[model samples]
Target: MLTSAILAETGHAAPTVPGLASVIPFVILLLCIAILPLIHKTSHWWEHNKNKLIVALSLGLVTIAYYQMRGYGIAHGDHATDPGIRTVLTVLDHAILGEFIPFISLLFSLYVISGGIRVKGDIPAHPITNTVFLAIGGLLASFIGTTGASMLLIRPVLRTNSERKHVVHTVIFFIFIVSNIGGCLLPIGDPPLFLGYLKGVPFLWTFKLWKEWAFCLVVLLVIYYAWDTIAYKKESKQDVTLDETRVTPIGIDGKINFLWLAGVVFVTGTMDPTKPFLGTGWTPFPFLRELLQTAFVGLSLVSTGKGVRAANHFSYTAILEVACLFIGIFICMQAPIEILNLKGASLGVDTPYKFFWATGALSSFLDNAPTYVVFFETANALTHEPGPGILQLLSGHFIREDLLIAISLGAVFMGANTYIGNGPNFMVKSIAEHAKIKMPSFFGYMGYSVCILIPVFCAVMFLFL
Candidate 1:
């Protein structure tokens, strides 16, 4: 029965229900994330490390059970391999070495390096100044990741607005612009785009999104300036005064991290799986990139002064929280990815608009990196292209360019729709709340995105998609 179920779900003879049972762990994890923090007021259970560990282990065990029952194993395993032990080993290898290690390593490198660079001094949080800050952050986001840019700028933005009462909108807009929409222009800017790059989309392919970037930036910045100006005026009417002494000339500490930052860029740009490390005699290991990034994290740790991290209030809590939750996410997400690979062409997502919304909607909930891969495969399937190369599909006219564009845009942009839409969104919110800036609840944050970001995306659909 188990063998029949697995074979049917894998599209061997005839399709069964595709074993959606595998996705239950993912849904439970997401529900806990969405609800647990909100109810932390009543039940302190969510606040305990033990509870988080229990949830993570529970979901992990479910994933193992699903894979075991399905007779799944490592990528190259044959049918003769032992299913139970091989399944456990494959899940551990994929989850830890393949996904979790690299993911956490890059994030830790960014966090440690960015945390070392303290922006010394506060610029008054006037509407225009705030707007300029966000603009800079958006541009920086394309260079350093959304996570890097968020960690680098959130503290300074908070400090600048320390005198203001109504600042939640500022952080909300920051998530919209810096953490999500700004990442559309480069593979380095977002995980989804980077996944595309790894799949043979040219590194510069995403630069075509400059128009989408400009559109979203212009609209969001204009609205933010107008809204902030009104809020500032209201606060002024309430007799608020800027503390001149609290203001200092803007500069940066731990400038050495910039060299480390450059190193990160170089590593990401040059690390190719198909390419040899040095010569034909030596091939690159799969974990080589993660190892290089981990070394960079070590450099940042030793190079920066303690004062810089202290000033930034740098702690491992945000990254720790992300690491805990995403393990369950990456594990359980395998089922949906498998289903999509087998059956996506039949899902009525043949058009560019459909691809955009479908990919974007799922990217809003699931980890966007894998979501992009799933939809990328789905789009490729529609073409029945001879090769898996994205560039090949484009150059040969095997796939519609508009369809690719829609998938790329959707996977990168709509990650602002909710806290879980992107990794950095929740990190930014957590950092803000840690600093005593009360961020909106998960659903409340969505309310802001619905009002502000959805219309801008609609304009994108009309003009670009």
Candidate 2:
């Protein structure tokens, strides 16, 4: 393969493929996330971050042991030069350092910084007003990131609608529109696209999917308006009247954090190691981005008053759970992703819609970021050589525009299908549950996704993919 040939020239290490059985731990871990929380006995136990960490690390260790037994175990000498150590380093680099650290760093920065800024008001949670808020969230998701927009908006949204009886649907739609569907336009919008940007795709290229973004948002917004109007009518007359009479002017706490948020956007937008926006690449030192992000995290903490985070009902638990679960998710997923990279071309996923659904279906269960990469390489596999395309990325290996759009939309949009699909979905769920709103169970949440999201995605597949 020319891709491998190019890597050979560049002295790049080829991936060490694990056998099929190795993927079991990955599947088991994901299933635990989905099922354990549903069981009456285990559900309470699963809520603890410590328990989640145990599960994640335990499963992760199983994979490491598998590698050890496979005769690629020993790493005694200098790990930098040894071939045995190369596999360990490359996989770890991809799973932990390359993928997880930068991933969690951005999320941490956004989560911590956004938590500093709180929207203060009890605006009447009229259907139109709620609709407007979601619209704003959609816009903010792309700029500040879905996690940032979700963290910033969920509190005010819940506070505004606190007077209403039926607001669970609002939160559900928030997860769908704000947390997932909204962040499709740019690298900062979602994890998968951001990763694509990092790997080789230009930062600005995703703006090409605006039509798909517009259609999904318009449709979801219309449905939400109609649904919320009905729900509002069902609310007790007293609650509606109370909401109307108690409107307060909205104000922002921690306004300085907006500058910090801009700093985050700027760093992510400009500081690409593979292709720097300003100057020569900085791929040699990968930690530079994480270092800058950490600085911003500290800046945000110092700049914003502690009182503001309290008002926002901020806690580390949400980010901590994400951090813990994802370490395992990234580690366990190596086998499946590698399989996709190798056997992807023979899978009959030759068309755009096939790529859309295949990537999306797996993304709904697995973490969408690596799912995007697997299918991305799969799409790259169809072409024997890099074609003239926008993906002008690593070693000049790129796929066509149509295939890239399919995978991108599939990853970003279908991530709304489940709690674990994208990073912010569970965080939104956690925050909403903490607000005393009873969210649906794991499979229960899927009910909402199945009914509302699937049809819209079908339409997207037909029209766009």
Candidate 3:
């Protein structure tokens, strides 16, 4: 019998119909793992290690089952009038079809390339050089976005501190300050600000956070410089000679992978569901657009096999692990998202600053994209008008542009509070660890955030925000 008909015959209402189709991937994963050892299929194994594949497949299935059971009740709820099907489908559509699978391959490729491009040569040994780099890095981040600046500069920073024994702290501080905080000055710099931009917040609305960004940068640079100076001085006290033999040019020694990098950014920026791909005016043909995106990404992967592979023998391990773990996370998180969205306004959050902190606090834990949406919804519910704020009277709204700016700044800035808070943050950390610089544990990471970032953020809240 047809699945829907069978369920109906069992006295299930339309609201009780679960999305059984969504479990197909999980089932396929399990079946592949279960029968892999029994059958001597060479193509089935490919280059993948079977034992690891089995473990990963098992984990993935377990995750699917957990989420499925959590969502099962809502799908088969008591009330026939409940929005169960809509809720379940939204979870499957957004978390699985929307996020996990599509971006995983691209993200994996980016991680490999990020690992390959190590900077060489001696940086200027001046005391203020690190500070200068931090300031320039922040400005670069504002324009090209944080990921661009981080990728471009991370190697050079690593190379500069290559000789120092106590330099890991310097790099960690760099990620905390330049890589994340520096994205605050422009809407294009981070995802949250970019979301704000699409939602009618001006590109320059980010300028309102300039004072905060500047304050945080200045403080962080001073701390970094102090740390760098002490490390340099300690090294100078010892008879450390500059390794002129190790000095090489700063550029990657292969065919530039600019096209591939550009494709990665294009996939990330353009695939967002909230944004309309087609505009009112002239547009690319829909079929051609998809074809072009697919071809560009595929060709970029092919180009990686060119002279670039010799320059850096790239492997897809770290990013593959990230892809595997995040698929489960993204899928499982749908349940929490639905529950949160349904009950968001009832949480009793009000006021712009309240939202500013609340959104930021959660953004520090959850992925910043959905966290932004949750608070955006809360702000939407609080006010019945076009925006997410209280209503006003004669000609002006109670919630001014500054208020929106504050909330926006908080969401974007505080995403740096932990490694998981932003996508690039954890990727960078993983890459750093792969390069043999030991990263802190989760709570240990939070210690750095609390010790340094919180004070700077508080100063912003007191002064500008």
For lDDT, the strongest prediction is: 2
Least accurate 10 contiguous residues by lDDT in model 2: 1-10
The lDDT of model 1 is: 0.78
Residue 275, candidate 1: alpha-carbon lDDT:
59
User: lDDT per model, in order?
Assistant: 0.78, 0.84, 0.58
Tens digit per residue, CA lDDT, model 3, 350-424: 665667777788777655656776676566445445454343322232334544655676677787887666666
Model 1 is weakest, by summed lDDT over 10 consecutive residues, at 1-10
What residue pairs clash in candidate 1, if any at all?
none
Question: Which sections of candidate 1 miss by over 4 Å?
Answer: 1-17, 40-43, 48-50, 70-83, 91-93, 236-239, 243-245, 277-282, 384-398
lDDT of 2 at 226: 99
Model 3 regions more than 4 Å off:
1-88, 101-120, 124-127, 198-204, 236-239, 243-314, 386-403
Instruction: State residue 407's C-alpha deviation in candidate 3, in Å.
Output: 3.5
Model 3 pairs whose backbones collide: 379-388
How do all models score by TM-score? 0.90, 0.91, 0.72
Please, what are the lDDT tens digits per residue for candidate 1 over residues 1-465? 112223211112333334677788888888887787788473477655567767877887888788778754433212322456655555565566566676777777887788889997887788998899899999989889898899999999998888888899999999998998888788889888887776767678889889989999999999999999999877853335564446789999999998888788667756755555434656565666767877888898898999999998998877777777777777777667667756677888888889988998988888777788788877866664454533463224355567788998898888899888888887898788788988887788888988888898889999887
User: By the lDDT metric, which is better: model 1 or model 3?
Assistant: 1
Best by TM-score: 2
lDDT of 3 at 182: 89
